[model samples]
Target: MPWKHADMVRWLHPQHLIRSGMDALVASIFGVRADHRLIVAVGRPQPPYFDYSDEAAGEDFWLDYVADTGDGWNSTYAVARLLAKPSLELKDPNGDTHALERGRILVFGGDQVYPGASRDTYEERLAQPYREAMSRSPDPSPHLFAIPGNHDWYDGLAAFMRLFCADRWFAGRRTRQSRSYFALKLPRGWWLVGTDVQLNSDIDVPQLEYFRQTATYMQPGDRIILCNAEPAWIHAATTPHPRGYMENNLEYLQEKVFGRRISLFLAGDLHHYKRHEDAEGRQKITAGGGGAFMHPTHAPRALRLRDGCEQKKCFPDEKTSRELTRQNLMLIRHSPFFGLLTGALYLILALSAYTELGSHGLLNIHEALRQLAASLVNRPMSLVVGAATLGGLVGFADPAFGRWRVPMGLVHGLAHIACAFLVAWGAMYFTVSTLGICAEPPSPKLAAFIIPGANACAGGWTHMWAKFLLGTFLTFAGGFLVGPFVMGLYLTVSLNNFGAHSNEAFISLAIPDWKNFLRLRIDPEGQLTVYPVGLERVPRKWKATHADRYSPAYDPDDPQATDPILIEPPVRVMPREQAP
Candidate 1:
């Protein structure tokens, strides 16, 4: 079946790209980080940190963490419904079951909306689905706290402020926090601190000061669970990178301000779950799998761990991730609009070299090949298309690709050029041979195309138009069928073999599987156990349940609706010891 538009976000969709690009440019110029200054000055919520030290559950309670959410209906709602459960029970391979209770506090690590942030998008992509799931949650509303991801930052935190900072009700969850970043001082000296690092740059001075002040209230032995939008540790580990600051800034907060008491570092953005643990048991975990399309965990850089931390566990695992990259072969299966763009490019190149194509039909392969080579040299428009293709691929290459970008981009771009020429020849053959639109084709070079007299005298406007329209349509059809194949093949190879285009390959897939979220429980001893839950698949068939009718508005019709699997065993972060 072809992709359902309602199920996933089409990142390549023109509207999304245009909006995201415009929003990013505007935010950079205006410096919207100032919104945090206004949020603090107004003091609407009065304080930067909300102290949850005296909860009804005392030192023991559940906390939910999810991020990189708000892309597709099926994926976002699938995770939302699971998170709203009164209790979630899953067994490890050994069959020891862990029954996790509903969280008293639900934290969105970042990227609450896909592509870009706008009130309408937030309302539909983030609010509507989560709220629909929340409709059935047996509740004493959970406290909702969130930090803005890059997409959220694209609109300068306006929509994020309206939703998360307004101190209103959302999806049966009470929204808290007066800013894009927040601090939750939980019971038994456990603190959950969320920071806003807009677009993976430095934390704003105001946000830095906010955390520094929040840090002042912490006790010496208190343990902090630090949450950030990006995994700076991963950035630092990967080389040809900027010397430090971003990671160091986070380090300064953890080491200087928080006194090295941060036991867990949590984040989202990559849209997959990965945990790295050091010898001392300090964990840096990326749990961005709330929703949105899957990011490949099989990529080489994704596996790189910094500061003596080993790769502890990851959702889908590396093997499964590699196998899934093969789905890129069917790129048009989801994003058909991409084919239109490629088809136009193919039509442009073909129309530009019409004299050559007409002279040597594809059946005359040797001469056609020679003519295409000459056309590339002689035809100005063909050269323009070739240059443009190369330039676009170079721009598409990720910054992380380093110097390898130019060569890899050149190869990928060349493939498209070759494919376009091949497709153009094929389209021309179909128009002349199969459709028989063109008349008097037995000619070389100028004679092949110099048939305005023959075309006009043959039949008049009807005959002329039949050739023009049919030729144009066949050219477009050839490109529509073959263009995306070339692109998808390049992306698949680039991502899996070359460690480039990780974003492009997976977003095109709109994979709703490997969906996951985290469940954290702080016991009486202040030991925090993290349970990473994963769904191998999301249900496409859903219906209103009549049994209780009070259950989640939609339930999967398939009895075998993908069961939640434990991505890994629970990870325990022991609290720091108190001063003697």
Candidate 2:
């Protein structure tokens, strides 16, 4: 329980000030020096893009991005192999085979690992896997960069900073950026700006100033590719304008600090892939599908559609998104390990109840069941009536059950809770009446029940009444707390699977086995193309490299794949907004 106590306290720290304090203490003791130097670089050349654009005197560049997908438990080994491979080998939907080349720069979006951001977690989850990938590849390693996500900040960014910022070889690549944020200067007046949102707090003064100085070096017409740690705009529940500090800061950087136009805005906290373009042709893409669990493409909270944006154009169509959502929900239902764990928890709870009551001579299993059944003789009618009434009301309000889901669930859950309390009271009354414990006088004193730690007694009829009242109250209270919790979980799972529609906010699915990433190539003319690669199997080199490590990190005996297949027909990046 003490080990679990830390986790309870840690989650309570939503602002993460406590974690930050711990990080400060850790850094002081370890003599950890934080880095914040910006790195600028020219992009790699791409012949196809250069040939297509034609008038190319400048160089070309490519950057691959993925986020919220660091899963050391599964997929990371295969993902590492894919990254190490020179190019993807795959067949398109038309059965045409092609090799999609790897990007020259590999930029991680964030959330490098699940559970927490500890050094051991990073070593196994990210560093060791990628390091092996680099070693197995014959080609030179691409320049590696990373921005911290909220998960990375869970341990106050200690491991993230060590892996991505400090001047050392991690994952078989030297840390290039001095800070969590950096600016990559591309050929032909293009720039890649990565920012640290600092765990939902405002951008630190140093980071803001660093970007301002970087902006001073740029011209007004420069095409900028913006990258952030979280998708603040899409995550907003009510409206896009209200819950968007990241957007506000980026807007200020574009309009005031730099006076430049943004070509592409990229973020990856949502753990799924999405592309949304405004009327002005500015692209806002969320591509977090790296290797972690998948998320659903739910509808945004606001029902109103934006001007000039159709259903599928703004986001995936409802049918398509729903299918994706279903796939994830089904994955959870069929997960062998998850089901096993749930069963284990129920067993533990049952055992705990039996142990506590058995020790106090309060539990007689056969007698308890017999009394429980007798108590429930007249109970079914009330539950049936309540459920039927609620069901009728729900059906009348919304046949599809979309708009009224939350309110309906809450009301129905409360009814079930009340029923549980009544059942508990009846069962307890039957048990105590049959056992005759209530008939015993308190500590052999006068015919009465005495308070445990008080000089108080209720004699004669009052003693029996007091015992029954206390038993009923305690049982009802326990049942009231537990019944609604179980009912809520069941209803939520049902709605998540069969009901709820998503836009970009209501993510309630885990896309199992479909690991993906994005490769963006900028031509000499400053035009960008995006290739979304999905892994269908593990790579051969991944199986061979550090083969022994697989057992501890991931069981090789498990029925996962050995080679990865890529998703076909990559999406082309539309042209940036024309320079004003």
Candidate 3:
């Protein structure tokens, strides 16, 4: 079965939050980052001995590149199935037909694994899917290389080094690079250099020296395709920390290391496809749509890049991205587990504030309000919880919103707290009025620790216990449904109208649409060609197939599986000397 949403990683879940904090702490204290890179320097694998530089291979050779993958099973498998195929024919909008052969060399741009780069996650999400797909293909094994992204760096790149740097056979692809980053000599005097930026955008000295050595092998008039973890160009323009090391270092590489040699720059931190071109024809492309949740391309809007490149193409476009943002209104459907978190928090807060309800019970609105107000001063812990919830929401607001986040986030948090109050009151009403139990409310002190019961009647204790259980369940269940709806609605409004939280908003939605990858070829004439291919939707239902003798492989259960399409016409780059 395709992995259910329940099995998917829930960012709001407490367990994940705890693990993330621990990983951050470890990265800070242990500082294995330097040691990990040193180990790679020592254990560097041999680069491909043969050059694809001019007639390096037959005329039919091509390569595949994908990034930001290894998350959900079905979605990852969808891209894997396409890549593993021996060949594919997709149509561009102009009715032109483009044929793509399975890449002889598979280059993973960044973040091949999600959450963390543990061997377990890579086996299940990354290796297994590709393995299943390759089993059906008749083609011989290909060469593989990958660079670590932030998620891969979560374990300080230990798992990534172990899996990708070992130079072993994996998923029908031979791991060629000895380190997390690599430099490959491609066909026709063109080189592909991939760098490791790790968690910070700054490249380590040893790794930069490795690339410096790569520059020595480059001859005059040679062109290069540079790949990095994050799109430095985009960050230069879109983020608050613009023009920092991310862009400056890339420029340093171009000016000091490989001047006028870079023909293209490729990256995939943002989970969508965007291509920008300078007037001189040099292109910087962001094609991250490799099976992760769709990020809105409409915001952080950069029509003209830092280097004077204009936007040429974008998959799902800005219009479609805006439309998809509307799905946040249906937030619970996408992130139902978020409700579990809120429900539990609400239950705890209500229990703490039980003393504030007084002898009047919840039936008396005026009296209940007075006690609730009193609890704000008397019960500091409950007030602290409510304040934290409110403050967190404020911080969650986009920093770009300026002071508006204070009001907007406070309103959002207050709305949730108000909902909790209503659930508490309703639950108490049912316990006392509907069930005729808890005629005398229990002490607030005991309620916070245990299920408080009445002691007046012989069986009043039993009656009060039943009332407590029923009230608690009702309050929690009601809060669960109400919580996500509130959160979803707030996220929807902030993102659609204010253009905020593109990454955070969609992760909650987990939309499995707009998945894409890049396929490249070096023609016999020595020109490079790129095809930006994508599918609008992933197959929701898949069936296990023994066909093609690939056991454990799957085909879409949906009778009419969607076909891939070109986001734009094939981009052809001529040799540097031959440029018009």
Report lDDT per candidate. 0.76, 0.52, 0.76
Off by over 4 Å in 2: 1-60, 91-98, 136-140, 236-248, 258-260, 299-409, 412-511, 536-568, 574-580
Predicted candidate 1 versus true structure: per-residue lDDT over 1-580, tens digit per residue: 4223355888766676677678888877665535554555456544857987888564468899999989888889899989877888898656778898889999999998887888988877888788667744445668899988888877777888889888788888788677777889898888999887776456666667888888789887888899988887776776555466445566667667776678899988888888998778888998888988998887646454656888878887888888888888888887888888888887876766654353346469988887667756766776786788899988887765677888878887888777777776666566655666555533343332242222232344554566666767877887887888888898888877777778888888888778889999888877788898888888877886554423566788766568887788888775355311
- Name the TM-score of candidate 2: 0.62
Best by TM-score: 1
lDDT score of model 2? 0.52
Model 2 over residues 1-580: C-alpha lDDT tens digits? Answer: 1111011111112234355556546534433233222121122111111111222256556667877655633466556556655567766445676566766667888777754678877766666656555633233546677888767766666678777766666554445775677777766667777877655434665566777777777777676778887765565433434545535665566567655366677888765566666555566677776666555555443222332322222223345555554443233332323333223333222212221121122355555555434433535544454455456435433223455665665565455434443444444444445444343434445443232111112244565555445554545444434443443344344445534333211222333355677777676666776666666433222223234321222223445554443344545444645554
Error of 3 at 142 (Å): 1.9
What lDDT, from 0 to 1, does candidate 1 have?
A: 0.76
Which stretches of candidate 3 lie above 4 Å from their native place? 1-8, 28-35, 45-50, 54-60, 136-140, 246-251, 355-367, 439-459, 548-552, 574-580
In angstroms, the error of model 2 at 171 is 2.1
